[model samples]
Target: MSDIDFVGLLSFVPAILRVTTPILLAALGVLISDRAGVLNIGVEGMMLSGAFVGVVASAATGSAAAGLIGAIIVGGLLGAVLAGAVHILKADLILSGIALNIAAAAGTTLLLFLMTGDKGMSGSLASQVLPKVTIPVIADIPLLGTLLSGHHILTYVAFLAVPGVGIFLTRTPLGLRLRAVGESPESAAIAGINVVRVQVMALIVSGAFVGTGGAFLSMGYVSWFSQDMSAGRGFIALAAEVMGHGSASGTMFASLLLGAAEAIAVALQGRGLPSELMQTVPYIVPVIALVVYARRRQRLLARA
Candidate 1:
């Protein structure tokens, strides 16, 4: 390719990473819960709530860090609520998750209306944006600088977390117990693992990761939270987790692919394409990827 063409293509890398950050973080969260056999279908709601909480807390305290912490705390509480619904109330897991999503959507809007007297957005609030990080030495490099430095802090955290999650799941004692419970709660119980406790912890951890993603949405991606700003990214994260087949590194790659699709759509919007059609690109890519993954899995099973 020509140098100009190559450079133009490379320009998209940063956008891809920026878009991928929240999806990757949330996908990792989904991976944790799924591994513990308690899929967090309410991850969408948790993310939406987190975004709202982050904005409100940041604006109220004049501290972005406080917003992030508040978001994480709220996400964990939502996860605990989900766990309670399943374990204590004996609610169907899937139904409970769906209910949470519905409640989060309505609840955030209601809270936003009460706070700023606006239900659709947080424009009245003076929320802080999380700062971007510029690696000192890396920032001086040519193409490497663009790819590796000067990203929102959460972007770095999300990427670094891939290996951290991988290690936790594969090398830790708690990881083993969580996996055992996921594989067979009955067997795990017989083996002396407290299935309920393990699942609860997994959901909390999952929600924490998800909350960070939500914080990114409001604090890093934009300085204000909009109604439904999550924009179905949480659902996309679920697809990424499924595409990842329960592996952190795989999920990261899947998130990048989906992020690239969204980035391309954004780019296309400037090229005079219908904005409505372009908006569907991100969602469409996941459907296609999932179909391919399902076919591949079926083929492997047949071969087996």
Candidate 2:
């Protein structure tokens, strides 16, 4: 920690924002599902599926928008399936999620091999990239503009989603019911809310958010999908949600904090540090942050 160069880190704000996009998006998904009383541990699988399908669809159609739509559709479908497994099939949510993640990892690799004869990546495909957005007046504001403007469109969407999610959960009727169901399914059911339906919907929405994050990985952050491209980001997003304690804004901030750590990890590469240790830094920071967050929560609760 003392070895980190503070001045150099300042220049990485944009990189932090860029990397934070997918994490924030995925964390939002986790937040919603958690709030709705359903935990979708298969978010990683959903993200991978979306990434693969998005790249494939965009390559075939020559449209990034189509790729995004494809990711969302696939993600939502997967979410619904997981929901069914937990709610209707009476499967353990954690075990079912683990199974889904394993299946998705293998299935996507197989599909990738079948399509491009390369299990590592879809380098052969010419996929369309999502456009970057530059705020008009904001772009001209010297230093501030440099930091604030010219991000991928999805970055804006991801940040905007923070508030949007908060509003949806706090101000909407469906949100209230979802929370009620999550808090006490029996009570919610007694009050005439279909607990199963709400859980299913929450999972679907969660999947959609994860899917969008996946799409950003393939289309916005990079131009192609690789096997296991999600690379534990789903888990990091989960951590962000846990650290945030299921608040949209808090989750967004947590994701950004992790993103900054990741950016520092990237920047520190090849700078006299052991390559393996530098690689581990990004993952290590989140664990530390989560521990700190947990400690803080415990203290607060003890005081209360």
Candidate 3:
């Protein structure tokens, strides 16, 4: 294409940031839970629940903050359910999480109908959501402003979560305990680390972030909450945790790669590039990353 199209590729930068926000946040959410040795398979459910709760609250009160609070609380509670079933009730985590996610999908949909008396809850301003925050100087800047300050507050939070999670995992005592629990639960238990408590706490934190990320889907990225709007992002976040090896920066990096692929798919869609491949791009990221990294590791081990 021409130089303008080349510049148009740069437009994907903002789109990347916007698209990456939810993934990054959800990835970070899984990072903590995974680090603490808890497999948070219910992230998808938590996010879907968050999206539903956030939109319903915002529609009722017309307040963004209220929606955020509602999402976090509901998300955390959903996470607690996951943690309780596995930790206290000694349930199979994978099965429990999958059940929760299935329940959340149907639960949120049912709630949407009950609240709005409509199936989709569209065509009404009451169901519309979160206010955008535009800083004066930041919004006035050139192209960068739209790419940066023009996004919702959740976008900034997703970016911040990288270092935030890093510090929490490295600099804090709780971080050490979480890691200890993850790396060696027996050792942590011997050391008097309350494994169950730590796992439940981590799940709560993870759910909070996941919920906030879902809120981004309903309130920040778009003004409407649709059925299964989270799509496969919650599972993608779990893959991100595996890909990142439990590091915050690594999680963000994984999220960015996925986000870039997704951005490309979106751009392709606007230009009517085959919808089949458009769907494929987003799904390809973890596969490619995992394969490449595995090969690299094998080579490094062979060299050593």
Candidate that would win on TM-score: 1
Off by over 4 Å in 3: 1-6, 124-128, 135-139, 295-304
Tell me the tens digit of each residue's lDDT in model 3 across 1-304.
9978967766678789888888898889889988888878999999998888888788788888888889999989988999989977999989999999999999888877776666564645244455656878977877667676766678888897789889999999999999999999999999999999999999999999999999988888777777788989898887777788668998888888888888888778868688888988888887888888889888999999
Cα misplacement distance, residue 251 of candidate 1 (Å): 0.5
**Which stretches of candidate 1 lie above 4 Å from their native place?**
none
C-alpha TM-score for every candidate: 0.98, 0.95, 0.91
lDDT of 1 by residue, 151-251 (tens): 99999999999999999999999998899999999999999999999999999999989999999999999899888999999999999999998999999
CA lDDT scores, all candidates in order: 0.94, 0.89, 0.85
- Could you report the Cα RMSD, in angstroms, for every candidate shown? 0.8, 2.6, 2.3
lDDT of 1 at 122: 56
Global CA lDDT computed for model 2: 0.89
Least well predicted 10-residue stretch by lDDT in candidate 2: 1-10
Best by lDDT: 1
Instruction: Extract clashing residue pairs from model 2.
Output: none
Error of 2 at 263 (Å): 0.9
lDDT: which is higher, 1 or 2?
1
